[model samples]
Target: MKLLEIVEQLFAQYGYLVLLIGLPLDAIALPIPPGNTTLTYTGYLAYKGVLHWLPAVLSAYAGAIIGMTVTYWIGYKFGQPLFDRYGERLLLKPVHMERTKQAYQKHGNKLLLFSFLMPGVRQFIGYATGIIRVPFRTFALYAYTGAAIWVFLFTGIGFLFGEQWKHVLIWVEQSLLYITIGLGAALAILVYVKWRKYVLQKKATARAIDR
Candidate 1:
């Protein structure tokens, strides 16, 4: 069955508990009903008055935070050993990990800040932060903020768009790619400027000492 269909039935049967339970699993990569769709549906339910808006939003956000936190710790404590020992079985080869590391070196924090909004990425980004040993303060700053935005954005879509939520999802997917590219280019330019200044400072320091 399609995920939405399955989700529909679950929501019909379980109501608020679905959000409370499903979102956390989705963060951990299980994605039983998928996070974005679920949130949108949550908004729709609130709009219909089937679920109260305040509790619905609260429950969804709490579930997402719990899932992300657990995923982060799992990566911190056990991710490396599991990858090292059983990477091939999981199809996460050593080369893949190395490339991810290099990419993260360049745009890790930027990606981390918005990772929760994207499906495949949201699942792994928490693990990446943990394995990379990002500071707890930094993780909370970016990850939790992203979660809040993600919850509000999608759920608000459902609330506002009503029956048209699916169409907006399509628009969101298309637009996000372009937005990411534009932001990435801007960040790259900023990084280049900072690097150039640092190099110039080092060169000037060396010349002065030699003189």
Candidate 2:
């Protein structure tokens, strides 16, 4: 069966349970139901009066946060050893970790807020944050806020579009490639700007000290 059909069946049989459980699993990177599709479907259901908007949105938000939190803890507790043992097969090296850590430090914790909007990135950000030992409080603040916004965005789309949510999904899937490329270019520019500013500041400070 098609994933959307399966999701429809699940929602029919399980109602809110589908969102509560399915979303968390998706957040953890399981390929069952895509998170955006699920949220959009939930929104459509709300529009159809099959589900309540508040509960549907809440369930999705909670599920995403829980899944990410669990993944983060797993990464914190076991990521290093597993990577040490099996990372070569995955082409993950120590240098990659070091570079990621440096980037995280330079960008600060707020960078995680956008992880959800990036394809294939939401699944890894939680794990990476944990492996890098980011404080849980900071992780929760940004990650949870991002989750809420992401959930609302998709759900609202589904709700507003009614039966046409599928078209939106298709558009999103196609546009994701362009969006990812744009985001990558923007990030590169931001990093370059920050680096340039830092260098200029350091040069000025050095000149002052010499004087």
Work out the TM-score per prediction: 0.75, 0.81
Candidate 2 structure quality by residue, lDDT tens digits, 1-211:
8898989999999998888788778878894778888889999999999899998888889888988898899889998888889989999999988888888987746668877877888888888899877889989999999998889888998999998999987787668757888878998999899889999999999999999
> Model 1: runs farther than 4 Å from truth?
83-106, 177-211
What global local distance difference test value does model 1 have? 0.86
| Clashing residue pairs, backbone N/CA/C < 3 A, model 2 | none
Highest TM-score: give the candidate number.
Answer: 2
Assess candidate 1 and give its TM-score to the true structure. Answer: 0.75
